[model samples]
Target chain A: MLVLSSPSGAGKSTIARNLLENDKGFELSVSVTTRPRRSSEIDGVHYHFRSRREFDNLRANDELLEWAEVHGNFYATPREPAERAMNEGRDMLFDIDWQGAEQLREKMQGDIVSVFILPPSMRELKVRLQRRAEDDAETISRRLANARNEIEHWRDYDYVVINRDLDRAYQQVLSIVAAERLRRDRSLGLFDYVTRLLDEQVD
Target chain B: MLVLSSPSGAGKSTIARNLLENDKGFELSVSVTTRPRRSSEIDGVHYHFRSRREFDNLRANDELLEWAEVHGNFYATPREPAERAMNEGRDMLFDIDWQGAEQLREKMQGDIVSVFILPPSMRELKVRLQRRAEDDAETISRRLANARNEIEHWRDYDYVVINRDLDRAYQQVLSIVAAERLRRDRSLGLFDYVTRLLDEQVD
Candidate 1:
């Protein structure tokens, strides 16, 4: 599991999109949510849109990896798909907040490699937020304020990438994924591999 | 600290050489030894030639990060150079054996990122040893046996790279280095940088 957290406008969504489009090896961990889906959103693709009762049951049964309540609607990462993907030897990418990241880490510490993307500076972050032009001035200001709260949690991540240059930051994330895949604890096939190597004949 | 360990002829030396030559950010942590230096080997560039008395003194005083006796001669990594490199914000590479790697990890658990390289197969390893033509058939056979002993310690490393293709293996190591550099604990400056970021004004 790969978790990426960033303050809004840090280019994390852009980086994560590039990774998934280019690397077919990863499957996105589609979250389950109680919020009603919009007309443009598709079920299971956008989110596993669940009823409030279903979301509550999933949480009660511990079927959710991590869950959050926002504005009285529930959002969660379903455990089944992520586990199945891992068992089938596929990597999973998660775009989650710091609190969700901590929960995932607690449940599955060894399998997860979390990265926090940082904007180059607060001023630059503000500039990017304003440039997006999708938000009102009040929402933009609120996001900037929330960015500091999120940025304070940067130290909790396994790796930190400063988005000074989008391409450079993306490449840094690629490196993290490649390197984590080589970790010995994660490579269970290595045992048989080394055994076969030692038993091989030499001329 | 970055340490690379592999059995002979597994392409570790070639990878380390290429990394040092291409990347100026790394400084080789040259080992100091009691063995007489070869005519072709420079004192500081290759190994720091030292007397047995001095080596013993350094080890006793905890001035050596790791020490071992090879063929009745003492070889050790000096603590000063490695620490100095870290203080200067430069990565230091150690081409050391498993025992040395263990010692380094014990001394500086948080700082060291060790990688173990494996030959593609035992048969391939034999071919590499024979191709080198540096030793007789008997010596090559003995080295092959020793390779298994060394390969068994692969679990001790944080990452493992199988040298199937030299370039790919090199890239994997490069990725490990890049990712490890971005580790939250290692980037000490991030704290102050984030502080400055939070305080910066946005208009």
Candidate 2:
């Protein structure tokens, strides 16, 4: 599964949506969460919203692939749905953060391919954060601090793309995904299936 | 299974070799052939030479993923060794033609990610062919004709990268492979394995 993780305002979600729109083969892996939805958020679309108790129950039962808490609310990935999609040969795209990515990587086989988006510099990060106009100075400051912590984990990912230019970064992300699909380990089963036919001819 | 295909002088082999030298995880899929070895070629490294009878035997049994004739000599991809490498979690890189890619994709479920390397223009391609200091003008012209025919298969590939500048193209190729590794369908089994552990937990 391809998990794209970046700090808030780094444009990971936008990139993921663009990739999904361009590639019909990709399926977005919607995360489930215990946090209350914003007015615009749609249940089962933006997220599968469960109550805190239900979320806790799911976690306790091991149904969640990976889960974590931020500001007292829990967010997680539902294990079953992603598996069903993959088994059906659909690729899943995840827009997440480093913490969630770390958890997902650990719980899964080394199948998780991760990419970290980085702003060109601290100055550029602040410029982008301010451009969003969604947060005030204080909130932006807090976010910038958190962003530093997140970017620190960039080394953990397979690719680190600097979003200095949106178009170039998007292309880089697309290329990475395209190349990964060709990975031999992922496609070895096809080799076996083809070899079986050869075996048939050998006898 | 990232297939990098281009015209005879497009430098795909050079890029593939560079990638192999730097990336330990990548295994070059050596082609099997019935052609005589040139003085510069090495057996089992550049290619595995086989007798016409053995080649016929492999073809009769469907052991080759793809096979074709060039200058009255035959070449093929031996299915078993490449498959084994991939099954063991290694990424295999193929420097083959479009026909080989098409055949391989048909026979197996390998990620089938193909990148067509294009010269900046016909003029550049001709210049590169001449710069090789090998073939005569007639051969170079024939190669250019062949390149145009081969490039018609670009739409069949997952990515199209123009090798205008070598370093930039190299980086783009690396980016493609890195992102592809993160594909969700490819990594789905990893997620399922992690979720299986949750089966023991109770709500």
Candidate 3:
């Protein structure tokens, strides 16, 4: 499992989108959220649009892998799909915050590879946010303030990529995924593979 | 520092050669050895051809970072070049056996990234050895016997690459180096970079 976390406008979503499109092996973990879905958003694709009550019930029942209340709306990752993905030996990608990442790490120690992305500069982050024009100046300022706090948790992550250039950062992220997959402990077939190697006769 | 180790015919040298040719940042740590130089070997390029007395004096004076006695010949990595390379923020590659790798790891715990290469099969390994025709039949048999013991040290490495295909294995090894360089602890500039980020004002 790969967990990617970043403050808004740090290019986490862009990296995730590139990985999903290029790397056929990764499946995104569709999160469930209580926020009202915009007309541009698809119910099951962008997020599993859920009522606040339903979201609470899932959280209370321990059916959610990780959940958090953000700006008065609840968001969570459902446990079932992620578990199924792992059991079937498929890699899942999570575009979550630090809290959710920490929860996933606690729940699946040694199975999670977490990366924190940072914008090259706070000025660049502000520029990116304003360029999107998705929110007002007040909201952008609020996010910028929150970004500092979010970056504090970067030390907790397994890898950190500074998004100075999109292509370079994307390549770095791809390298992390490739290297982690080849880790001896993560490659499940290696033991048997090595055993078969040992048994091969020399002529 | 990066250490690549494997049994004879496992392609550690091939992978190392590819890396050195392609990656400008890596410098090979030419080892001083008591073994006689082959006709094709250069005095200071392939190995630092040294007498047994010189090798012993270096070992006794703590001038070698890691040393091992293999097949009645002494091999040692000179401490100064490696330390200077690391201090200058350059990466050095060590094409050593498991014993030298273990010693380097002990001496430079966090700085060393060790990779163990494995051939696709024992039969393939034997074929590779035979194809090289560098050793006699008796020496080949002795190497084949030692290969099994060498492979037992696979679990001690940070990364393992199965040399099923040269290109694929090379890519994986390159990916490991790229990702390891981006690790939070290894990227020394990240802390100050992030600190400056936190101080930037939101407009």
Query: Mind listing the fnat for each candidate?
Result: 0.86, 0.23, 0.85
Local accuracy of candidate 2 as per-residue lDDT tens digits, B20-81: 99988899999999988867789999999999999999999978889988667898998887
Off by over 4 Å in 2: A1-203, B188-203
The TM-score obtained for chain B of candidate 2 when compared with the true chain B: 0.87
Q: DockQ: which is higher, 2 or 3? A: 3
User: Per-candidate TM vs. native?
Assistant: 0.89, 0.53, 0.96
Per-residue alpha-carbon lDDT of candidate 1 for residues A1-203, written as tens digits (9 for 90 to 100):
89999988999889988999999988888889998896767998878999999888998998999998744778789899888987887899998878789888988767888999999988889899999887789978888887888899998999999999999999999999999989988887998998887778774
TM-score, chain B, each candidate: 0.86, 0.87, 0.95
Give the residue spans of candidate 1 off by over 4 A.
Answer: A34-43, A48-63, A71-73, B33-44, B49-63, B71-74
Error of 3 at B118 (Å): 0.9
Docking class of 1: medium
What would the per-residue lDDT of candidate 1 be over residues B63-148, giving only the tens digit for each residue?
A: 99889875488889999989899778788999988888998888877878899999998888898999987678997887877788
Per-model CA lDDT versus the true structure: 0.88, 0.77, 0.91
Backbone Cα, N, C clashes tallied per candidate: 0, 14, 0
Angstrom error of the Cα, residue A70, model 3: value is 1.7
Which one wins on DockQ?
Answer: 3
What value of lDDT does candidate 2 attain over all alpha carbons? 0.77
Judge candidate 1 against the unseen true structure and give its global Cα lDDT, from 0 to 1: 0.88
Q: Candidate 3: where is the Cα deviation over 4 Å?
A: none
